[model samples]
Target: MTVNIDKLTITTPAATSSTNLVALELSGAQAIERFPQYVTVLSDGSVKLTAPTKGASSKSTHRTRCEWSEPTNWTLASAADHWNRQRMTVTKVNSAQKVVISQIHVRGDDSPPVKVFWNKGNITMGFRTKYNQTTPVNSTVLKGVPLGAEFTVSIHATSKGVVTVEAKCNGVSGSSGALQLDATWGTRLFEFHGGVYNQVDYTNSTPAADGSICVISDLSLSHS
Candidate 1:
């Protein structure tokens, strides 16, 4: 049997605005067979959540959802040797703007081609688009990757005749990018997006008894 105790105190009005300040206490016998137990507080002040269980060597985790208002702008930074997937977007647009995203990957799979897109949604096959008159803007393709290596994907677009952009992760057929080029709004962008399909093999045509693994991460979005 395993047992542990954990407590949390929320100290903001916005954190408890939605829910009625419930003190969650989870106590159980074992980790693999334990369920989350809930408790409530009736005071007008802060709420304290406590959990105490029998035995030892038990692993317990806690998480809380929160919401707050910012001053229309905020800066976010990620440390080295960190991996997190994200999609960036700016609600307002301005001139001479550029969205620069950079990350230092400590250790990750680099053999497969990681596809990137200019906007939201999953990677779509058999898609193409034209940027400007200089050349027919087509789907951008990330070249081969050396296994157990580090690299970066950068895009520089301007409001000056820049049309569309697309990126596909582990793609081999057709192209990936802007689904449509006739849309308005001169918003420049860059993003890292991906999806997963369970398969026995990445390039095998025959069905197998198991499924494959796919993970897409590190997405940044902005406009210039």
Candidate 2:
């Protein structure tokens, strides 16, 4: 059995260099690489991730985030069931009141099959139907999710590469139905991520308090 939290790394809003962002790796010796301010594991086994809107970020991207990612990689056909399920509460939001909470990231680029967002009080998602789809199709998954209220979000995909995502807030539920993936995604390696990723780009004058924060009460990842 694998401990879900033990198999991941935290990608912070801190920059590594002029061209890259830092990844606080959690492993053997790299366990020492963690930063409490950005990624904190509470005594109750929950995790708190913070991303200041004006913090350091990659040169290529304008936003910032503090997200936990599965260290290893896998293709869509790697397992019959590949999923990321998390119980999270957004305690804070950026100036734009929008932030990405989960994603299905493709290994070599910014392109991803899924980008789940907490837009204001609505749970929205962007689905990229094909590998080369420049822009994902966006839709609202759920609405009226209040800040600081716990909610569950799940993104699942099977060996066939068909994806499904859903959200539950205050006993209300919404789903993405079934998002079909193209053959171009067959050989692409992917990973699951969840946490506070600020969607709005930060500028030098942006207030430090203009940030996003999320507390994850439970997270479960499985592939079979």
Candidate 3:
């Protein structure tokens, strides 16, 4: 009945490494609670996540994300179905008006199989059919979504690696249909990540006040 984040690890935009710039990470309740400005539990139990456009990012990547990653990784062959369901409201966005809201991430790969984004006023789905695909195929699944509005997104993968993604907002809905994953992904382990991921990369002159922020009011994950 409630969103549980006690076991999730939060990757904050806080600067960590001095050399190649990577953000600090916090795990569990005590650790995550220390970074309230980026991730915090609201009075109603919703989890708020923030990532500024001008924030520290991984040395290899250009953007930043105040995201919560599910610690447990599951394989496609390990279960009949694995799913992540999250309901969130985006309160702020970067100058691009785009942010990744939820995603299915591989254990070691930079490319995720599924990325559901809140782009402008449209709910877009970007998918990677191949494990190492450099770019994902993009499609608009739902529309009419506005800033500060509540929406729910769900993504699931079958044992055969068939992925399905859907979103609903203000009674409007959209789906990614059925996306078939190639065999290249069969050997990889995956997990779910949700929250605000800024689409823009920060530079020296980027304003600290500009960022992407969202609140996850409900969340759940399952494997069976």
Candidate 4:
């Protein structure tokens, strides 16, 4: 399906902010406020997100991104009654560092309960129900793909709050079985995000001259 650029929103770090924690949304009325620095849309319709080595502050020196979201907000009550799906590929990862490439988040939640990551030389998909849990959903690691390689990842949420995750790379694929959502998430809204979210801090040290660049293509979101 063709994606509607007008309905998509791009978020990145703000240029001038004291807290160094504000994000600039590119699309809404705020689009005119400041031009996006880390996120950009290519002429071919793909999205690219860059994470600088050093950011606004030490607390978090990186940027978070979402490819797109469903127009209508959804909650657990609507579970079993509605569905949300997201798909994207990791076209190019400039570095071998770990990065959050996608997530399924509940509104108001500081962090997404479900996240997909590119770690070292492998792909890891994890999930959590608690805000303070240190461990993620236990699962086997999926082999990594090289540059120009394509990986299709998707998630399907049922009306009963059951979430299913699937991924495909080089003709091999696997599933997360069924992940039961926490009851606490029942009343909260949820959405899908796809793009690079650097997991490292570059403050007071130097790892790579160029932080990292994550390119995602064939991004599409749909719900019913």
Model 4 Cα shift for residue 136 (angstroms): 2.6
Q: For residues 1-224, what per-residue lDDT tens digits would candidate 2 score against the true structure?
A: 12245547776776665665543334311332446677666677677778999877665677888888888999988899999999999999998999999999998888798999999898999988889689989999998998999999999999898899999988999998988888989999999999888999877789878999998998888899
lDDT of 4 at 64: 33
Query: What is the TM-score (0 to 1) of candidate 2?
Result: 0.91
Per-model clash counts, in order, read 8, 0, 0, 4
Estimate, for each residue in 140-172, the C-alpha lDDT of model 1 and write its tens digit.
334432221222343222334222233323333
What TM-score, to 2 decimals, does candidate 3 have?
0.95
Ordered from best to worst TM-score, the candidate numbers read: 3, 2, 4, 1
Better of 1 and 3 by TM-score: 3
Best by TM-score: 3
Overall local distance difference test of candidate 3 = 0.87
Give the candidates in order of lDDT, highest first: 3, 2, 4, 1
Tens-digit lDDT track of model 4 for 24-91:
44552233234445655557665555655445322333443333444346665664534333345544
Prediction 4 global C-alpha lDDT: 0.58
Tell me the lDDT of model 4 at 89.
54
Query: lDDT (0-100) at residue 62 of candidate 2?
Result: 77
Q: Kindly report which residue stretches of model 2 are placed more than 4 angstroms away from their true locations once superposed.
A: 1-4, 17-34
